[model samples]
Target chain A: MLEYFEILGQEVYKVLFLLVPILVSVAMIVWLDRRVWGLVQKRRGPNVVGPFGLFQTLADALKYIFKEIIIPASANKVVFILAPIITMTLALVAWAVIPMSEDLVLSDINVGILYLFAVSSLGVYGIIMGGWASNSKYPFLGAIRSAAQMVSYEVSIGIIIINVLLCVGSLNLKDIVLAQKDLWYVIPLFPMFVVFFISALAETNRPPFDLPEAEAELVAGYQTEYSGMMYAMFWLGEYANILLMCAMGSILFLGGWLPIIDIYPLNLVPAPIWMILKILFLFFLFALIKAIVPRYRYDQLMRLGWKIFLPFSLIYLVLTASFLFYFDKLPKGNF
Target chain B: MIAHSIFFYFFSVIAIFSSLMVITSRSTINSVFFLILDFISVGCLFIMVGAEFLGMILLIVYVGAVAVLFLFVVMMLNVAEQKQSWFVGKKSNHLPTGLIVSILILLELLVVAGGWKYKENLMSSSTLILSDISNTHQLGLVMYTDYILYFQLAGIILLLSMIGAILLTFRKRSGVKKQSYFTQISRNPSSAIELKEVESNKGVIIDD
Candidate 1:
């Protein structure tokens, strides 16, 4: 065992180093979500709690840790216990593939986009499992709605991604950012930017598309039976997914770690700072939209996804393909 | 090289076992989840083989979308045993299937061990060089240049699948009202109708 540990010496350090930012980002996002949402509603927003609610989530976490976990009498024992763990784990794992900076990524795998998508899709299982395991009608209904809603929007999201992938010619997030060094793809692919952003909101089950959590109907949706820390896991995972999506959007469309106001005759800030700033801006946008937009009826939401966004993205993909083919002669960097 | 080979074998065993469980499981829902696990392991195997692009495609398209949809419907319709007949059968055909699967596994093991004499340059020469093209660069190059036609073929396949799915599920139900785009767009109420009134039961009111 000692020899094996020696063999894996630096690998352990690399793993731990990778874990820091992921943990920090999830923690900060949890704090930010509560504070921001509270402020938007014209409330005191955790000011008296501990230094502007910085420690509110932490306090809540501790409270959950000490609380008794009660399984409902009719609940499925094994799945009920495992669902939140899986949900939280998958949500955290997605941050591994996200490129925070050039060298800051953990996995930096080739199929980063696909990995992100796959992990998020698995998240739906967590919701489904939680709902079904509870043996309750409302959660079951919420799970079904979530399954349909996520699946429907994913199609348009995938197609819009095709358009962006065509522009970058790579699936790796770092490579996508490097491709955007000259100009972000948002300039030319503005429509795709819109499609991807909206689809991401839908994908993360944010407000307006948040049918799964429609409190008036499902009484907190798939989490109706959850209490204490189990509920906290679901909450953490939700905000984490939002943060992950924002990070990916920043990296993919917003030139990731590139400075927006590059007026200093050179890009000065480290890539990670720019990445953080871009993510914060996108995060604010996400919260703003959540506050401003009214939830659509279920049918209207489905129609928007399947009818409008899907067809539009397919057309965008075709246009992108045609341009890439026709301009094959152009110098790769010139444009 | 030995570590990589051992990891590959380990994941392959798990993948194969989970895949078998996917078929043999009693509950349709359990079977679906097992199938997801199998696909994830298969994806890991794909990565081990330096086929990252294909692995990602398998992850995104099948495990992410198709398998989730399968699980979703299985859990939703809550099909009774009657409806599960197509998927779950207690018939005793497992023996033959098991035999066939074991035979294939044995053959693969034989090939891996020494039957093919394929182990000579398996690691030293190829392993170091494999890392260079293992990323998306070579995959993109081949996709855009050599396999461009095949890429287009995949697009056509997806398009066909889209149309097929829509056609299969778009049937209008009998009682549920659906809006017609034509009526909504082209309707001029003045052209279609003239207003009139009739006497009410209580008031005996009338209008022209």
Candidate 2:
């Protein structure tokens, strides 16, 4: 019994170690986004209370926990509650497969890339359910737009990822990073990187693709009826997914923990630090894009996703596959 | 052994319970949601079987698309809530279906636990050789080199399904105006409507 207990305890410790970093990482990303936005806009962001407002998310969490959670009288009780839970859970689960550093992943499964994409797509269900459960016109309309928007962008996103998978010849995140050992794939696949970045922003419902929650139109969109901790969960999940995407993009296109040019003791900074720095840069890039770009109209976004991005991604996929084939890089007979 | 056995029993019970609920739930929408839960549990079972790719695909494609479409259709339908209540008094009528499902569930458990040959197979292969090395390369090698033809077949099936769905939705209606470039080119405003000037009988030459 003691021996068995030891094994189970070890498993629990591993799970805990994985979960804590992600939670703290999410908090850090939110704080950094706010502080950096302030710097960029030439204003101090939340400097009053705790040191640089590092405790801002903590304070907000306490408020959310204490706030009255309102379930709309007209809403479907079951789905309304389950929707946010599902959304947050999916967002958290995706990070399980994303490799932070070379060997630091929680579940380094064979199909890590596919698993990430699959879980992320599951997020659309939560959005759809939340909107439908609200039993209101605005939420319903927002849900419809979200469904169309997600589906459209996901097609392009899938195609773009095919290019990455082709370049690496493996679906594992660690392997993908390893493939970038010589030169970061972004140097060669700059156009695909741009396409993947923009499509990812749209996929995550960031600015320029936030028509589903367009304040002037839908009035908070699918989350119109949510309140208290449930709403906070949704917000946190959104930011976390953004962070996860940045981490993934870094792992896929950038050299991940591998240094740029490997000059002057690149080993001095720990692998984890390098990964964090890369993710932070990508996170700032996301915010900068948001600050600069205005929201697109619904039709325009759909057209861009389908007409422009999808074709380019498909072409990129073809190019990648062909290049791999020409170089005899694919596991033979695939081509 | 006890811990492993407990988890297996627990997840199995959950999977069975959720699947039964999928059929028993009153609302079609609720049933569809339950179906998703059932799929997730099955996905868990796949994970236990060391078929992670298959498990993820089950979640990705079936739960994500097919079940979603099921929910969409159910939600969009104008089924009356009262009609759902009509079958409440006829519980006995559903006894056969329930009995059959329970039997099926029992069979599934027996099969999963290896019924008769389970001991033999367990004796033969107790340890699966999965080392610290990543399995992605081997899987890719097998999938591409050995199973490429099967993969292409799956793609063809998907293509066929897409075409079938499109055909079903493509309905032509009579008396609906269809666009034509030639008609637009030949059109003139004067030919489409008549304009006339009349002498004014009242003040200020009224345009009526």
Candidate 3:
């Protein structure tokens, strides 16, 4: 019993080490997102708070915490309360398997990528539950739209992952990164990388594909009823998810934690910094997309996911498989 | 081993309790939610028992996709007030049939679970549990090598069902206009418009 408690305590400490940085980065990323958006529009955003408005998100967070939480009388109380918590928890929990650098992951399970996929796939429940529990028309519509969109895009993402897996021969994230030591997947699998990045945008419900929360039509969408800390939880969860996508893009395509050049000077830099830089670079692109692109029509989004991405990814999968098989470059699976 | 049993019992208890709630919940949405909980707990049980691949697949395929669709349909149908208690509705005739079906299913599951002890043929399969490999690699090896035909058949079955679903829901409405990007994009000035010399008193007759 004493040993078990000791193990549990150590695990808890490790988890806190991983999660604190993640949470703080999430807060910073929200600031970064807004700042990027503001810069795109030629405005200085949130400069009133601390130096360069770094504390803007902090102030906003405090406001959310101090505000009142009003649950509608007609809403389903249990589910209403559970939705945001689920959203935030699922969003954060997926970080456990995301390796920052060599041996930096919380859980180095063999099926790390699948675990991430499953968790992200389950992320829909939060939106669905929140929308349903709100018992409002707009939220419900938003929830339905999001549910279908996530499911559709996930198919292409799965195939895209399979494309990388075919090359790496293992589902381990570290193995995936190490496999790219010779060359990053973004070079050869360029089309799939583009598709994957776009799908990541859709999966995270970022703008352009953010029809679920289209303010023009659906008001605040699934968040129509949430306020106070609950609303902040959703906001926090959204940024965390976006960061997760950025990290995923970095890991799969750009090579997680691997230095851009494996030379003496560049390789001397810490691996985790490279990982963070890559994630930030991807996030910058994501923010750029949000500033530049217009929201997709619902039918247009569906058509892109289904008619274009689905077939495109499928054909790429076959092509990659045949290319590997013909050249005898396929990963000979044992380990 | 003790910790293993503890986790096993914990997940099994949650699975059983949530499945009970799935049947007893007043609202259909709540029932679907409970169904999702049941799936998650059962999936955890699988993961705990050294079947992590199967567990993740369960979470991904069933809990993620299947149950979400169930919730979507139930929410959209506005049947949340499905408050008619089991065995109270006038259609209580289903209770007898339900009980019979339930018992038959229980027996079938029991056979699947305990048959290895008694049935020689069932234990004769060549694929023994390989300890060295991860579950996913083991699955890939067996699935692609030994059970390749069966796997291909499963894919065919899934594809056929998808086609059947689309066919079932497909409708042809003549009057409703649909966007055809191909036709719209292919249209050119030469094909779409032609200039004609007009007679003095008449506008150009537009019949092609």
Candidate 3 Cα misplacement greater than 4 A, ranges:
B84-89, B93-100, B113-130, B183-208
lDDT of each: 0.80, 0.79, 0.90
Pairs clashing in candidate 1?
none
Per-residue error for B189 in candidate 2, Å, reads: 26
Per-residue error for A298 in candidate 1, Å, reads: 1.1
As a whole number from 0 to 100, the lDDT of residue A129 in candidate 3 is 94
Query: How far is each candidate from the true structure, as Cα RMSD in Å?
Result: 4.8, 6.1, 3.7
- Which is the better candidate, 2 or 3, if ranked by DockQ? 3
Pairs with backbone N, CA or C atoms under 3 Å apart (clashes), candidate 3: none
DockQ for all models, in order?
A: 0.40, 0.30, 0.71
Mind giving the per-residue lDDT tens digits that candidate 2 earns over A132-206?
Answer: 898888888888888778777878877777787777767777878877888898998889889888888987888
Q: What tens-digit string does per-residue lDDT give for candidate 1 at A1-335?
A: 58767868867787677667666677777677667777788875666557776777778788988888889998878889888888888888888787777887777776788788778777788888898888899988888888888888888877877787778766777888888878897888899888889988988889879999899888999999998889888878888888888887887789988777566854777888888888898888887788778887788889889889998998888888888889882225311
TM-score of 1: 0.84
Give candidate 1 misplaced runs (Cα > 4 Å).
Answer: A1-4, A7-9, A327-335, B77-131, B134-165, B179-208
User: What does candidate 3's lDDT look like per residue over A206-243, in tens digits?
Assistant: 99999989999999999999999999998888889999
Query: Candidate 1: what lDDT?
Result: 0.80
* Interface RMSD for each of the candidates: 4.4, 4.5, 1.0
Q: What is the lDDT of residue B101 in candidate 2?
A: 94
lDDT of 1 at B6: 77
lDDT of 3 by residue, B1-208 (tens): 5566677778889999999999887777888989999999988877776677898999999988999899988887645334444334546556798899999999999889887565432222122334877788888889999999999999999999999999999999877767899999999998988777888898875643
**What TM-score goes with each of the models?**
0.84, 0.82, 0.93
